[model samples]
Target: MHVLRKAILAAACTAGLAAATTPALAQTTLRAVMHSDLKILDPIWTTAYIVRNHGYMIYDTLLAQDEKGVVQPQMVEKYETAPDNKSYTFTLRDGLLWHDGQPVTSEDCIASIKRWAIKDSLGQKMMTFVDSIAAVDAKTFTIKLKEPTGLVLLGLSKPSSNVPFMMPKRVAETDPNKQIKDFTGSGPFVFARDEWKPGDKTVYVKFDKYKPRPEPPSGLAGGKVAKLDRVEWRAISDAQQALNALSKGEIDFVEQPSHDLLGTLKKDPNVDIVASPMLKAQYVFRPNTLHKPFDNPKIRQALWYAFNQEDFLMATVGDENYIQPCKALFICDTPLATTKGMDALLTSNAKKAQELLKDAGYDGTPVVLMHSTDLKALTNLAPVAKSLMEKAGFKVDMQSMDWQTLVARRAKKDPPDAGGWNAFLTAWVTADVMNPVSTAYVNAACDKASFGWPCDAQLEKLRDDFARETDPAKQKAIAEAVQLRVIEYTPEIPLGEYVQPAAMRKNVKGFVIAPVPVFWNMEITK
Candidate 1:
């Protein structure tokens, strides 16, 4: 009996040792609530931030910007620029593979850049100087310019919406006017399209085959290591419910929490509020220049005269600490910032606005204004605009809809009463509007411009000059000229500027500070 007991005790000790050495098989999932529901998956189709964030998850860029806004190589292992700056050669890094197990080649990138250039504002400007973009070999490509210009690398390294996300040649060949059906990408995560629920949840799983860079992670650059096995973006539209979820540890992150409820989130010992200076944004009121009364630049200018930046700022962001009354079209406190032609327009005078309307042959046409109900920061903008415009002697038709629906409806060129909109309230990251060429709303390329379709030959000329100029002082002068033109044409109204912060559980770490929120290089600890 003693020998049998000794054998059993020895077996139990061996079992315990084996258990201690085994690895855990459970998958780690980081659940998050993004700023908006991701209805559009094609980043090239729209400039929506949600779609751009989705693009970052599944697509990789050839070049990226670091924390300091310096452009760096991402997919490209090395690159060389000619002395004349008319040609650039790029070589792709090794170990890069598509989500479908295909190798990433130079031909794929060339096709992707061509497709992106067709829709993006910066891309269009860069293409104006490009003579040819051809692949030299399976892994090498070159961009030959018509003349020397500095926009080649800058356009490719653009970090905001309409980012140059690389895809397979087959998918990239899709028409720019239509969305692509294929969702294959070469980024750190593989999109789980089979599990995507448009208004509920979107899932992404780490791509085991992805080879991260050896360098340390930086803002949208360097190594993008997916630390979690799975990531889920839950669509919780109600801000209070999202905050409650964060407080109770039900959700790991909230991309944009309501300013009023921020105090409630701060009271939670388990939550951490992260406010990054890079996340500041500018609110805009865009008018459709294809239809009246907004089709008349004079009418558009009248709205500007009636607008009060402080009223919009107060209504959207109640917390005085987070809002700013800015008049510069190119964001205040940045280079090229100016209020050149803004003094006469942004007066907030109802009588002055009425006088202008009368001078323009006052037609009491109802302005079809779109109100996005789902967005917390934008919900109050249309209401305030309606109140202000009505007081200025303009009939306003306030239409309500979710943000995604508005995003789609705004693209229609039909008459306002015929399934079209006259104007809408939206916001852009400060990074997106820093310059005349990069700003989408300010592009005056007629039919080729953004949804507003504000066509002005002088404005386009000024933007082209800004893009071609290399001198800082000359560029600033060109930008101010562009701003003055924008004020006169009134393509879009600059409501104000504000800083938005993200909230997450205390266990979430390594969140990268960038103009746009990214998921890689982050992990959640239990």
Candidate 2:
């Protein structure tokens, strides 16, 4: 493993040297090392963060959340909600045009929202209350709901994965289950498809035709002024080499630096580490409930008691400064955060796990754990999980693959041995899982649920109740009930929480600090 890492770093260093030696372009271009290689371009098809980031570069949203988590208008010039909250009318801002130079219309937004609703958890919940979504005119649309609910604007303004990114009607009409070939959007940047090389680099050129909102940029809610002529997302998988490149002026930014290397980067006066509380995430362990032994909830419960939160946190994030031992399903320090029904399970008890396995009539089916070796933050998780599960008398078969491959493979519903997965580890930004409706993994909607396919009708009902109840006290009570049901079902385990900091050269300025990275309003200075 050490030798392979060394080889990767060596190659990256050579590439950095080449970049440094190349003649500088006349146009201002910002070269960045993103968290992962860009492979999948269709954000609606998968909940991958990289793809969502790509979506933000090329597509606009109807509304967006500010730094304070307040939803604000973006593409929508203005909107009005009826007193009953059963109807919402939205008018698109002027000068919105697709990459192909066609004016963005109400029909386009409606189609985009419908497509996103099919795949996003929050969108699905919001759709349940929606009666009709019709265009009033070229630039105006109205959504009529069967009942009053706050999920309409909230779903549209969701700040993270599976974001409702507006696209041309032609592109938006594509089936949500399939990837769209069209890359047309009306955002700040235009995707340079011809320049894209999946494993090496992805390119984007600023869309000169895009009109920035008049409001000052706040989180992802306001103006997205593209200050750079071009942006290049160069794939440098090695953390040390990426930082070395940044220090030497080969690259301007690194989306995620390895936790242990922060001190070294801090010593370099040229590099700046940007860490935000909104950037915190919760690592999760999801068991595929479609196949045994996970199909049996009791068997799933056995492993719950076997694993410890602190072990997972320490194994993945060695830096004590970045790690947090949290058991809250919703996320610690949030309004819905709670440790209800987690008292006995947060601490490891192999003996108790073994007893539960016996009570569940275990047939010794091996759990197929998928390990994403490409992502630095996720590579250690499967090994640690394997050790903990084996300690509890569970047979484990660990499979290794790149993060992109794992993202594609996790969607399969086949049996474990038939190219399907039994369990996998992934993390979500706090914004993605802050509440019952927004938490994709917590949705127990049977076939409609996120990967792992865990279904509990009662749990689904509780989530619906939480979404419907508006009273704060009543909502808290319902949220606790939902958390208790999640504990009882074990749909997904909340391993722990940690912060991921982004490092960049001091010359790269105006970077947004939202839950997800956005390249707008940023400029490169020589």
Where does model 2 exceed 4 Å of error?
1-26
In order, the Cα lDDT scores of the candidates are: 0.88, 0.89
Please provide TM-scores, in order, for all candidate models, with all chains considered together: 0.94, 0.95
Candidate 1 residue 46 Cα shift, in angstroms, is: 0.7
- lDDT score, residue 217, model 1? 82
C-alpha lDDT of candidate 2 relative to the true structure? 0.89
Candidate 1 C-alpha lDDT tens digits along 1-526: 4344334323422342101111122167789999899888899989989999999988999999998889999999999999988999999999998876679999999999999999998898889999999999999999999987788888899999889999899989999989988888888876766668888998877766689888888888999998976788999999999998888889999999999999878888999899976899999999999987988998888888898989998998999989988999999989889998887766689999999899897689889999999999899999999999999999999999999999899888999999899999999998899999989998899988989888899998988898889999999999988888888898888888999999999999989998888889889886
